[model samples]
Target: MRVLVVEDDQFHASYLQDTLAEALPEVTEIFHASDGAEGEEEARQGGIEAVVMDLQMDRRNGIEAARTIWAERPQSRILFWSNYADEAYLRGIARIVPEDSAYGYVLKTASRDRLRLALRAVLVEGQIMVDREIHRLQKQGAAPRNRLDDSEFGVLLDLALGLPDKLIAERRGMSLRTVQNRLLSLYDKLGVTVDPEDEAVSLNKRVRALNRALVTRTINVETLEAAQRDLDAWLGGRG
Candidate 1:
């Protein structure tokens, strides 16, 4: 099998290549790309049976690169190795992946044996494997059929951006009351409660809710970044 290891860190990339070569004797060829752009270019060259992708990269993020690669070759298997199990990263992966394609999500901190296991699972056995920690967080942070639907998640993003309810409503084409109701639902889902009598608790409920969602891995940096990009585009169009 031919494998491509796409990682910015030279040491980690080398380690993965060496480990895979040693563990999988059938792996005839292994390629390396230091960044996501290079990875995309190499992927375009073809003959890549499986990819060990890093989630974050300097020039182009892994998600962006993976989206392009999968768009062209939906059959290519991929194993995501990253330090973060951020909901943003997971959501990004969940959104673009082709149906019926095998994939794995394993942390960089995973043991070498575990990494090898994930590689074999996705690359050889065509199985989906997610790190236990990340899988647990995914379940806890989601309600049945998605604890926070897209609309609620949108409201959470607006609140996380520190937008007023009116602005959020205007941006979402929702009434102020509807937006406020969504915010209340978000607070409930995120398990954030505010006490009107507690004068000593100085933090605003919205801020607290956002922070709690972040701390609990219900929301993450990439999610905020994506939301900010959308807002910027919206503002630019309005201008």
Candidate 2:
């Protein structure tokens, strides 16, 4: 099977290529891309059966690249290899993945055998493999009562970036009232709702929610960085 390894680090890319060659004889031909944009271009060329995608890249992230690949080729199998199992990354992946698609998420620190197993399972056997840590975070983020939908997550990102309601509405192309509603939902999920007894302390729900998200590991440096990039792009487009 032909595989594409998409990673920004040349050493890691080469290492992955070599590892796959040594570990999996089924991976006959391996292609390499430096970043997500190049990876998407390579995938678009149409011979790659599976992709070993990196989460963070220069121009586009693995999540964005995977979304485009799955959109064009719904049957494509992708193995997300990254150092982080951040909830933001998990949520992003969960949001765009085609229903019932075969995918895998393996951390960079995983053993060589583990990586080999993940690749073979997802690429050849058509299975899903998520790291244990990632699965834990996924479950925590997917709790029934507090799970934040895509809209709520987007609003939470905006709030974390200190975007006012009006600005968020403009950026996201939603009505002001809709943005507020999403904020309310976000606050509820974060358990930042105001209590009559604690009215003074709970007055600023936005700040409380942001704090809660940080404590819960829902949003972190990577999450904020990604959000900032999107916000910058939006601002640039508006100009």
Highest TM-score, which number?
1
Q: Clashing residue pairs, candidate 1?
A: 143-147
Report the lDDT of model 2 for residue 26.
87
Model 2 CA RMSD to the hidden true structure, in angstroms? 4.5
TM-score of each: 0.76, 0.72
Residue-wise C-alpha lDDT for candidate 1, range 1-239, written one tens digit per residue? 88999999989998999889978887899999998889888988958988999987887778877887898899999999899877767776776789999888999988999888888889889998888978776776675654777788888888888789988999999999999999888788877887789988776789888888888777776666656766887889978
